[model samples]
Target chain A: MSLLAVGTLAYDDVYTPYGEVKMIEAGSCTYIAMAATYFVQPVQVVSVIGGDYNDDFLADLQRRGSDLEGVEVIPEGKSFYWAGRYHDDMMGRDTLDTQLNVLADFDPKVPESYRKAPYVMLGNLTPAVQSRVLDQLTERPKLVALDTMNFWMDHALEDLMAVLKRIDVLIINDEEARQLSGELSLLKAAAKIVEMGPKILIIKKGEHGALLFEGENLFSAPALLLPKVVDPTGAGDTFAGGLIGYLAATDDLSFANLKRAVIYGSAMASFVVEDFGTRRMQTLDQEQIDRRVQRFGELMTVSL
Target chain B: MSLLAVGTLAYDDVYTPYGEVKMIEAGSCTYIAMAATYFVQPVQVVSVIGGDYNDDFLADLQRRGSDLEGVEVIPEGKSFYWAGRYHDDMMGRDTLDTQLNVLADFDPKVPESYRKAPYVMLGNLTPAVQSRVLDQLTERPKLVALDTMNFWMDHALEDLMAVLKRIDVLIINDEEARQLSGELSLLKAAAKIVEMGPKILIIKKGEHGALLFEGENLFSAPALLLPKVVDPTGAGDTFAGGLIGYLAATDDLSFANLKRAVIYGSAMASFVVEDFGTRRMQTLDQEQIDRRVQRFGELMTVSL
Candidate 1:
């Protein structure tokens, strides 16, 4: 089974207490495709970038089985650029720069070959753009998951709520969940958000863990408790990518399978935070991924 | 086998969004003994109270198999009085009043029959008082679990460390774990904390959940997702009580048993938050408690 991802692909400069990096390759689809490759193959990506990007990065994605035919590159324009600094705890960050040169006019074009992929992941982007991708799909994928930020909730509620009604799953951080639902209690927030649209709501609680709420059932996914988190820029997108990819591979949407999917997603995210800007995710082999996932299961088991 | 709990006994005036209760029977030992009685028999308690306390409250404790021979009553003084207001989130509270009354000169006295009890749960109290109870023990108990607060970390670090060395387990909230270890990452904090004394650490994250760490093994317990949390005052102490009480009843301290203990603790803690000042706990029956605990098990399980 194949997975389809649609979002921005760009160059990012990130600062953290541990250190700083300049002009590194990053973006929503970038980390998503990288992490998803560990689970399902032929990750077809639909995103827009500019001529300023490096060729080696494209080669890396393609080499990892990413179908980049839908990745548009405009030679005359600069790529989307973002600069941010992570706080000491790695839970919060301040956006220092965002030059949306090509992304400002980003018009995603889902390739004809990619439109019928079995799984779809809508990475953090404009809700209208997310909606546009759904409009382009020739048939509904087996699973449709959407990830959004506080930006859409603040500026584009109409578009966001409209898109939310069409997706099967919504992946967001704890703070975003609170802001979007206006509920202080997460349990109440999950109930409210599910009422608004998606059948499943996954609230990502950074290092604490993740919670999956579907109907009356819930599953708590454990995050690998690391001694340190170097950079957490793409952890959430990586998690979403890992999740949808696992679902596509297993071809099951049962709550039991989705629980395992969350564990897989958590393992992928744990790798992302260990290094800077997709570096650790890029080098992860299947054995290393399986080992981390096994640990999650061990961390949760109790023989009674 | 018996469970011995040593802590404060007082009257609490609580203000929550749900409502307010004036001079309700409450205390660290009150909730602990109530929760412990659900799992084990002969819950021996050591604490001080005032003559002004209600006789019906004492009758209720004895009705639940609480051996109160060690409880000291001061005829001329008022009971320890506390007033607090829960914040909107229900995760934090502000102390509006604290009249130590008889607790000012509180002296814990462990009874002879309680000295050899197989399980000990020291609810939040002064480090010196916690240590004194340990010193009074005739022989080392099978398991000694100590729960404390940030107040002791700030004022009684030396004594806390001394008691920590003698205990088998330490239970504290996530914030206190960070403060005690001076490590922001919980994984690193657990590594440091285990080195200081106790071999096991349980970091309670109010509504988020709880994490158990013992050497390389770990377990995550999910907090019950309530539609509304009326009060959170004695949830932690109740958790400690449930945990030790289960251990005592089962007479097992293996890793597998400890994992079950935490789940029982989480189940007990969840009940405490549903109402004000031990109201819910006082009314709980065994069947209701077991059903909640079974639900927790189902929530955490992920079939591979």
Candidate 2:
């Protein structure tokens, strides 16, 4: 099964309590595609990157089963860049700078081969651009999951709601959930967001864990608590990518399968945060992933 | 098996988004004894109360199999009183008033019959009072769990550390754990805390859930999501009470049994938060508690 991943590809400078890394390859799309490729081949890439972007990274994506046919190259233009410093707690951060270059006018065009992809993961972007992706698809995807942030909810909520009606799943963090639903209680917030459209909603709570809501069913997934967290920039996007990729490969949308998928996705996210800027994702093998997931299962197991 | 519960008996005026109540029955000892009575009878209560305290409430505790012989009543004195207002999110609150009338000079005296009890639950109190209770014990209990707060850590660090070295189990909220161990990471904090004394440490996260750490084993229990939380008073004490009560009744301290006890404690805490003060605890039956715990098991179940 093929999956279409539409989002940004950028260069990031990050600072954490452990150390600092500069000009690293990072973005929602980069993390999503990398995480999804582990579960399904040919994760079609639908994003824009400046010519200055590393050619070696492109080769790396191709080697990992990512189709670059849909990726647009804007020569003489700079890629989107962001610089941020994480607080001591590692849960909060401050954005030092943001330079939207090629991404300022990104008009995503889905390649013909990707239009009929079985799964789609729309990483954080403008709602209008996200809706454009859905409008170009020739065949309905088995599952369409969208990841968003408080930025879009604040700037383009009307358009966001328009896209919300077209997707099968919505993934966002806890604060965004509260902002979207205007409710203090998460249970009440999930109820309100599900009414807006998607059949499945995943609310990610950074270190606390993630909660899944489908109709009357609710699943709470516990996050694996690591002794150290190097970086957490793309943990949420990686979680979404792993989730959709698992569903596409298994082709099961039942609540039971979704529960397992949440655990798998959480397992992937746990690995991403262990190192900076998708470093852990680079050399991960199936044996390592399976072992990590087994640990997650053990971490949550309790007969009573 | 009998359990000794040493803490304060008081009245609480609480305000929540749902509504507000004035001078409602509340106290650490009251909630602990009431929750523990579900599993073990003759929950011996050691607390100081004023003549103004309700007679009906004391009679109610007796009806629920609580031994009031250890509870000292001062006819001319007033009870400990507190008033607080919950913020919109319900996780935070500001204390409006505190009147430590009878509790100001409380010197807990464990009764002769309760001195040799198999289980002891030391609720939030002055470290000196808690230590005095422990000193009065004629025999070492099978399990001793102590619940404390940041106030004691800030004011009575030496005494708190002294008491910490004597308990078998230490239960405190997440923030308190961080403050006590000076570690932001809960896993690391738990490690540092176990070295200080207690063999088992439980970190309670109000709405998020609870964590149990024993040697190399860790159990995460999810809090039941309630659509409406009237007030969250006495939740932590209730959790500790349920846990100790279950252990006392079952007489099992194995790690596996502790895992079950966490869930059982979490179930009782979920019920107490549904209404103000101890209204829900006043009317809970064994069937209700068992059913609630089964739901907790289902909430955390995932096979991957």
Instruction: Pick the TM-score winner.
Output: 2
Every candidate's lDDT: 0.90, 0.91
TM-score of chain A of each: 0.98, 0.99
DockQ of 1: 0.68
In candidate 1, position B284 carries an lDDT of 90
Q: What is the TM-score of each predicted model, taking all chains together?
A: 0.98, 0.99
lDDT string, candidate 2, A1-304, tens digits: 8899999999999999999999999999999999988999889999998989999988998899899999999998999999999999897999999999999999999988889988999999999999999999999998999999899888999999999999989999989999999987889999999999998999998888899999988888888878889898899988988888888788899999999889878888999999999899998988988998888777778876
Residue-level lDDT of model 1, residues B1-304, one tens digit each, is 8888999888999999889999998999998898898889899999998899998989889899999998999999899999999887666789999999988888788988889988898889889999989999998888899999999999999999999999999999889999999998998999999999999999999777799999988888777778788888889888988888888899988889999999999899999989988889878998898898888878779876
- Model 1, A1-304: lDDT tens per residue? 9999998788999999999999999999998999888778899999998888899999999999899999898999999999999888776799999999999988899999998887999999999999999999999887899999998999999999999999999999988999999987888999999998999999999887899999999887777788888999989999998888899888899999999999999999999989999899878899998898889888888764
Question: Per-residue lDDT for A209 in model 2?
Answer: 86
- Candidate 1 residue runs with Cα over 4 Å from true position: none
Worst 10 residues of 2 chain A by lDDT: A295-304
Error of 2 at A131 (Å): 0.7
